[model samples]
Each structure stands twice: as C-alpha cells, then as structure tokens.
Target chain A: MSDTLLRLIRHGQEQGCRPHQRYLLDRAQWATLVAALADMPEVALLGLWGDPGQVHAALLIEDGLLIASCGVPDGRFAAFSPVRPGAVLFERMIRDLWGFVAEGGTDQRPWLDHGRWPVTGPLAANPAPNGMAPPQPVFLPVEGEGVHQIPVGPVHAGIIEPGHFRFHVQGETVVRLEARLGYLHKGQIGLMLGKPAPVAARFAARLSGDSTVAHGWAFAQGVEAALGITPSPRALALRALMAELERLHNHLNDWGFLCNDASFAWLHARAGALREAVLRAANTAFGHRLMMDRVVPGGVSDDLRPGGDAAIRAALAMVAAELPALEAVYDSHASLQDRMVGTGVITPALAMLFAAGGVVGRASGRGFDARRRPGYAPYAPAEAAVLTAGDVDARARIRLAEMHRSVALAKGLLESLPPGELLVPLPQRGGEGLGLVEGFRGECLHWVALDDEGLVRAVFPRDPSWLHWPLLEAAIEGNIVADFPLINKSVNASYSGVDL
Target chain B: MQGWRRLLWPRLAQGLVSAPLTDPPPVPPEEVVQALVARLEAAAQTRLGRSLAIRQVDAGSCNGCELEINAMQNVVHDLERFGLRFVASPRHADVLLVTGPLTRNMREALLRTAECMPEPKWVVAAGDCAVDGGSFKDSYAVEGGIDAALPVDLLIPGCPPTPTQLLEGMLALIEAQRAGG
Candidate 1:
C-alpha cells in the first residue's frame, strides 16, 4: 500500500433557484468537474451524463449545484467527454434517457431506459425520465479475443433482483466483464415531483433500502434547504444515531457472509444471529426494524422511548460483548483465513485512484470515511473509525472493527440523549436543501429543491456506490474467476443507488 | 429396564410433554389473510392502495434475511403475507425483489427474468449490506440488484428489516400508490 493522493476537485458551484432554491451543474459542467477530479495520477475512471440543466441540477459536495429549472426535452444535445477514456455507459444513459448525442463515446446506446418506460425524458424539462416509460431490452456487445461469452441473469438462482452480467472469458479466465443494470427503473423521481415533502421522503428511502438514511436525509436536505431551516442539534444527533445503527447492522451481516463464503458455517451463523438481535432491538425501540418512515423532513419520526432506550442499552452491551468472540471465530478459522486473506486485493494506489469508501478502500489501506472526509456531525463527537487493509481480509477486519465502533457510538447516543422538539416547525413555503449523510455504504449526497408549497421539485441523491462501482470492476481484474463471489460480496456496491 | 441416565433424559422429555405448543403462526396465505383482514382493514389506508404485500428476493445476499426478513414476518408484529405476501416468483408479484451484488452467477438471470412480472412492478432494497453488494460492493462478478434492475419502490433501512418496520414500508408503498399497477 503506497501513499497516493486523490481528492475531490470542484470546478464551481451550480445554482439551485427558489421554491427549490438550489443550484446545480449542467451535464457538461459535471463532466468537466469530474475531469478535473480524474487528474489524480494513476486512476481508472468513468463519468456520468446526467441532464440537470433542463431541470436545475447541482453538485453539492463538489463543484456547483443547480436545481428547480425547467426540464429538458429528450434527445437534445450530444454527449461530450473532454477527458480521455470517457465512459461509454454514461453516453448510453444520456442518449437513451435525455435523448442527447454522446459523441465518440463507446457503446452509445440505451443503458437503463430500455424502451418499455412510458416516459423517457431525463426530466430536465419533463420532471420525469419519460413518465413511467417502460424499458425495452437492449442487448450489449460482448467483445474479446478467443472470447466465449456466458451470460448470467437479471433474475437469479438465489431469488435476487434482476441484472445481466456478460463474462467474456477464455476458458475459465475472464478477459472482460460488463454489467447491464436498471431492469428495475420505476420512475420514482417523476412520481416525487409535486408530492409533499414527507410523502416524497418515503420514495427517497425506498430508492435503495440500504440507503434509507441517506436518501431520507438527502430528501430532507432538499426540503429543509428549500425552507432554509437547519435540523435541531437533537434531531441531527438522532439522525446520526439511526444512520450509524444502520451501518453497524450492515457490517455485521457482511462479516457473516465472508465467513459463510469461506465455509466457516458456525461463525457465519453467529454473525447472522447477532445481526438479527440488532434488528429486534430496532423493532423494540423504533417500531420498525429497518427504521422506514422513522425519518421525516424536519427530523426523525420517532424518538427513543424509555423502555426502548433500555432495550437498546441492553442490546448494545450484549453486542459489544459478543463481537470479540465473533472476531475470534473469523480469525481462528484457518479455512476462513485462507479463503479471505488475499482474495480480491485492491492496492492502495488503485484505491486512491478510484476514491472508494466504506470497507473496500479501508481494507485496501485507504482510510477514507465520509464522517471524516468532510467532517459531519455526531461523528464529529467521535473520530471516524478507519482501518486500511485493501484486501478481502482487510475488508472483513474493517467490518469487525466498524461493528465494535458502532456499538460504542450507539451507546454514546443513548447516554447523551438530548431533550428537545422532535420536529422542526416549518412555515408554508419554499427553500433550498442539501443533505450529505454518511450512510452505511459511504457518502450519500442529496440536493433538493422545493415548490412554493413544500412540494418536491427535484431530488438527486448520489450513493457511494456511484464512485465504487467501477472500482469493483477494476479490483477483480487479476483475481481468479472462482474467487469473484467472495470478492464481490466484500465490495457490495449498490446498483440502485448508482442507477438513480 | 432403563438406567437412571436414560430415565432422566427420557423423563425430561415426558415431563415437558404435558404442555401443548402454541400453534405455529399461520403460514397459509389464506389463513394469514383471514387474520390480517381486520388489522389491514382497520389500520389500512381507507384508500384502496393502502395495503400491500412485498416479497423480498434473496437474489444473492448472505442469509442476513434469516433475521431481517423474519423480522418482517414473525412474532412481535407478524406481517403475514396478507397484503404483503412473499411470492416465490415475479409473475405473481406486484412489487419487485431485493438483496444483491447480483453475483458472478446471478447477473443475467436476475434481469431478463425480473421483467416477467405484470406492470407497475416496484422494488425495495432492504439492507445496508445487501444486494448492490453491501460490503461486497467491489466484487467484479456482482452485477448489483434492486435499483440496477427495475425502479426500486422503497428501501427498508437496516442490515435487515425488523419485521414491524418492513411492514411499515409495505404499508407506505401501498398507501401512497393506492394502486399496485
């Protein structure tokens, strides 16, 4: 793991106007902005082609953000990539959804918006990507030398969601891999337009269930940003608590998978059981295990009830005590160690280039935690728990470490419970909002604009996987094809988050 | 004829046999429907779209669902298949599936197959550490699920949904949409 430098480089601030008083970057600007970011030496990169100009898009965490402008008609401008080796898939999205030209980009065809969608505009002008436009399946080209192609589903043997992966392999060795996603595009962005803030939040959280906190907060950021209201300290603290709780639960499950994949059945089962206990505690405390509907525009929808607090305390103590043994099981099992130790290794240099977050980079020895990166709240109370391993084993270790860290934070939040109004009071109208939550996966940046009546105008939440998806493609390059399952499980990037 | 050890071990079972077990929670979709009719009709959005049964697909997630999915279905507040049934396939499903990293193995199958369901299909990703690869977000073999496939309807936040909470999301979707298709 070498010392490599990669930082977000912003070009400018995009504006998001009134009603939804937020500004965003145009598709062209976003490309230039990322191009500047792509300058990090020794990087593998791709950029997105999102048409927010017609609809007021913004770059909240980086350069500029623009929101609440009119929608752009489909198929208008041609896509341009000022950077060398521009992304072909991005060009596909621009052409298919926005009906723009993607000049000289590879595979310039539909990516997500497969003709079945009822509406196919990017909502730059229409407020929807072609309202409920159904997608017609568009095939992708499989290329390589002496390549025999094998295609595995959108539906799966494990009964998971649908997605197509084409493996262009020579014998058993994979020469090239292409991921075809967005079989599940449901036009939520279109549906959110004109919906009340609270109503829209559900859609946000639903965008990717694992991203509930990020999407909810991102949507809330838009509403609150529109109203120019800040979350109460207590509200912010609670939001942090729930978000971390979500992170801990997710990490525990991932650790369990690592063990399971390596055939450490008992360790896997224990992790699984412990994760369930956390959910049980959540159900006891928040009334919903996943905490859906718990977050609203102003603040959280639920607070710690007296009994619930006690239940959580008990659960935390148990988890904190139980985690060490679980780690021991993972460490002690020789087979588990062998299976995980060096599988799917992502070097520090590569990690820096990709700028990946969560456990992937941490394991690869790149210490980038969103809580630490921009320095957000509650987490500000404590330091970001960063571990640099950069390997499957490293990622697993990070998951174990993060679980312990989550327990400590959960305990701290409970002990320092703040007494205040749960919801912020709001007037009848508009304002701009920007929300950046350190979701379990990593950074979830959301920018929103509201109408005069607090209705949602445009909501754009960027999931951490947006950055990590390509990195996943790179990390698996030299690894044996069979080791892919373990490696893929360890990286766990989100398609829905990136697709949205 | 039994020794004391045998008597103690066998006797313990016989002693415990006096109590009858509570019948298992009704699993038949019909039985669950019959029981939830009231809860659904009462707490349900008086609106037609207020009740929904969302089935989550394991796709390829680590069996984290043994708890999370169970949380959505079991004891404290069991969300029976009532308005939210967990159908095995997409054909009968109204809302779409969940969990993933789409896996080296599951990629193409998950896609061409998910669309077979009737229109107005929606998806819900239920965990942190799930199907868009969760911790496995970087695996090259994984295609990522949920949002990558079809439009996800909602996401139930957590590594797994507490049974009661997942129920809330199903309710919210049904209530908000007021129509499955």
Candidate 2:
C-alpha cells in the first residue's frame, strides 16, 4: 500500500492559511485506500458526499486527520464494508441518498428511504421517479424447528422515539434480533443544503434534542473552521460549560431511567427531581431548558445571565450530594444486580469491528473518546474515565462515573472562567472543514463544505448512534425477549441522530 | 431477623427524604389558567364528570417532548393527582397525545394508532413539530404536521413545550372534549 494512492487534490493555497485537502484517487486506487483504512489500527469515521455523476468517500483515521477520496466520476464504486465492517451503514446510506451503487456491497436494503419518499435517492441529480415498487426489506432469518418471529414497533408502548425491532426466538430466548430504523428521517441533509452556516446551525441544534448543545457546538466549529475564525476564550469556556451541563442532565436522566427499568422506583423519582433542577437552572441561565440553538456559528447565542453560575453550581452540588446515596441503593439491591450483570455483553473485538463509541465503547474497553483524542479546548488536559467491564452493569457504571466527572469539570471551568468577548464575526468566505466533538452519547462528527458565496454545499453530521446501533443487534443475541428493554436502555442509541 | 435488618436497614435509610421531595407547581399565570378554565368550564358542562385517559404516540420527535411528558408523572406535576393518566392502549384512551412532524415512514403507524382509539377521542399535537412541522417543515421525509395525517383537535406549540405549557394544553383539550366540540 503506497501512500501515493491517496493524493491531495487542492483547489488553491495561500501563505499563512490552513489549506484544506481533498484527496483524489483513480478507480484502481479505491482498493488501495480501502485496504489502507481497514489495515489501520483504529478507524474514526466513514462518510459519503455526492455530486452530479460522481460520489466521494471521506475516511477519518485515528490520527485526528481526514482523508477524502474523490474523482470516482461514476455512480459505481467499490464497497469499503467488505474490508471494514463499520462502513456497512455508510455504504447503504450512500446508495440510498446518492443513487450510487456500492458494487459488491453487503446489505443493499433501503436505509433512510423507507419506500414512502416521493422519489428514490432525493439527493441525486436526477432521482428515480415515484411508483417504482419499493423493494421488500429482508430480515435475515434464523431457521429452526421451533423458531418464531416477533416484530415490534415503529409505534412502541412507552413514550420514546419510534424504531422497529424484529426478533427470531425459540420460546422466550431470542435467537436473532434485527433493527429496522429510519422511522424518524426528516431529510435533515436536504434541509441543510444551500443554506448559510448561521441558518443551518439551527437544524444542527435540533438534530438530536438531547445532544443539542454538543451538535450545535460541532456545527459552529465546522462553520468557524470553514470561514477561518476562532471563537473568543470566554465563548469557548461558555460552550464547554454548556456542553458539560448538557451531559450532566442527560446522564442523570438516563441513570434514573436505567434504575426504573430495573424496577427501582425510588431512584427514578429522586433522579427525576434532580434532573428537573438542572433543567430549571439551565432555563434560568440560558433561556431554554435543552439549550437548543444557544450555541451558534462564530460564538454562543447569549452570555450567562447574572448569578447564572451560582444557580448552575447550586444545582450541580445537589446532584453531587444526592447521587451517592442512590448508587448505594443500586449496589445493595440484589435483584437489580441480577438483572444488569452479565447481560448484553459486547467484547472489545465486536466493539472495534462496529466502531462503537461513548459508554458502549468504553464499557467494552475501546478507549477512543473524541474529546480526548482530537484534544479540543478545555478538554485538552482532561482525561476521559474509561471502564472495561463489557456488560450492562459496566455501561450503567460508566454513566455514573461520567456524571461525576462532568459536574467537576463544569465547576472548575466556571470558577476559573475566562474574561473576554463572547462573539466573533465570521467572514463570508467558504471552503471545506471538519468539526468533531464528544457528545454525551459519544463522538459527534460534522463536516461542512461551503461554496464561494458562503452557502453550504453539503453537510454530513455523523452521530455516534450510526456505529452503536449495529452493536445493539449483536449484543441482544441469546438474551431472552423479556430482558430486551433492560439491555436496550444500557445501550441507549439515538434513533433521530442516526435516522437523519 | 437480625441479618435481614442489617441488610435492609441501610438501603431503606438511603431512600429517606430530608426535605420536600418536590417544590411548588411552577404554574402558569392566573390569567392563562383562567382562560383555559373558562373554555374547560364550557366543555365540562357537556361531559361533566369524566376523567381523561391519554395515549401518547411519538411520530418522529427527537424525544424532547417525550421527556416533558414523562416529567408530568414526576412528583412536581403529578399528573395523576388531577384525574389524568397515560393509558397503555388506544382502545381505552380519551385523547391521543402525538409528538413529531409525522415522518412519511411513520404516517401509517400514526394513523393506525389513531384509528385504534375509541370514538369521541381527541388528538392533541404536543410540540411545534406536531403542530406545524417546526424546523422539519421543508423535509422531504416528513408530511409537515400531524394534521397532514390525522384530524388534530388542538396544537401545543414549542420546540418541545415546557411541562406547564403541556399541562395547559391538555386541560384545554379536556375542556374541548367536555364541551363536545
């Protein structure tokens, strides 16, 4: 594998300017690039971008660098999933969104386009017309004498997002579990095309409501990178504060939910009250409970209100004081331990193959946290708390550990807050740039390519759920159908993030 | 008995609450509640003595509205104390509380869930996305709002409405149903 297979295709370069590199590879070179990516020790991301008559593949390697291979010049290209299993969903998305056929690809089923779209391949230059009968999606069968199939929702029993799961079972034990998603696809990419970075930031904020701060900051970083602007120190500190706050609230909520699933109603109620306090603090400080659209391109939407830091500190102090008692209850409850332990285990090998991130990846011993890896501001010197128990109990414990760390981080950042301007003016100049952030869920990566007029040419926001969801299918294997909810909560993958 | 006490005492002690478990209701202003009450009174006159049963359906939301809905059951709002409860089935529901912009893939599922509800059932659009599609209005995969698929009786607008707003919206819907509107 010669390094020359991936040649940098430059549009232009200037002195003292960051030159964005887009690699060009011949058809013969596609195999070499795929091999190089597969052979690499760690794979960060696999994304696809399409233009009329051609498609490009972007590979983010572990070294905090992106290698985008273009110039395929046709709809047909070699599939990377054959070499790297993590590329399976990305290839399926490319086929559905771009009308590009992943030649020799596994899993050709429709991903986000679930037969109801007006036309197939909406992003293609000339999309296929409506009324072409949608292909019947095949669920890989588990055949046996007594095996039965159980199909669950696009509409579930509880108040949660919609996704379908089909289980092949013999009696109560699940033989196979297949997830059918994209029930929440709102054509997010299509909504962002041609919009200015400022306008597109709103869409990014709502991409996943729970991870709004993380997604919004990533989008802001993307736009800032493209326009060659850096936010002020104060703004960066504020953003980091908000991100940690978001993480704290979400972790508290999940911990409550996990306890509730394990039949611990007391912890659930206490956690809810604490979570509400955090949200109220956020509302008083930032004007929105979820902090949606508060992080915008160039800087934050607003500065902290008077006494906001105290309010946040008070709320965090309450949570920090209360969580240990709840954890004591969780530890002492024999029944809860029985339910969580040794269930839905994912070995490190499987996690790496699926490229799992966040608590799921950490639980399984893959220590790749984007915040630590790419080393962003504020988190550059911080270390991610990694645990490797590889089970449902480990996942829950990881959330607990992260919640404590996030509280401490928020306190430290607020106490030593930087004094400076909160906003910077971004120039209306365009190029390509990448933004990566460690969201509460895992790594959130957003890539933006802007036209000369500063309008977005394309934007791909790859959520950590894209990689984690496939691992859920594998983790549920051999577990009883009754334990599905408990296992599912442990790996709480976002449906909307991946659906988009 | 000694061993049992040793094992359970610590765990039970940890669950104790030193102060009030929840704060005040954080209720909306009197005028807003009065306006809602007036409408509810008119509706209440028609169906004077019935409680409301809600069946929540998430069409395509980002789970923000779902969070608030779940919060209604918490100690603060304690929705059940007001004679309202979330039922497990649409067959028993008096109102269908829906969230999301009605994604195309979920249109059939939403319609089917709505159809499962008994007659005289009301549909309350829970968030801005369910009301008018919000940020996802221009999306190709979404049909804009719940109105595009079902007859939405009321619209509660917020990116994901606050719990107070949702409570008001539900109260209004209950009154609307009581009035036989």
List each candidate's DockQ score: 0.08, 0.73
Model 2 CAPRI rating: medium
Off by over 4 Å in 1: A1-91, A102-107, A122-146, A381-389, B1-67, B70-181
The top-ranked prediction according to lDDT is: 2
- TM-score of candidate 1 against the unseen true structure: 0.71
Deviation from native of the Cα of residue A425 in model 1, angstroms: 2.2
Considering summed lDDT, which 10 consecutive residues are worst modelled in model 1 chain A? A1-10
Q: Residues A261-360, candidate 1, lDDT per residue (tens digit)?
A: 7777667666666666676677688886667668888888878755778777777777788888777667776878888887777777767655566777
Evaluated at residue A210, the lDDT of candidate 1 is 62
lDDT of each: 0.59, 0.80
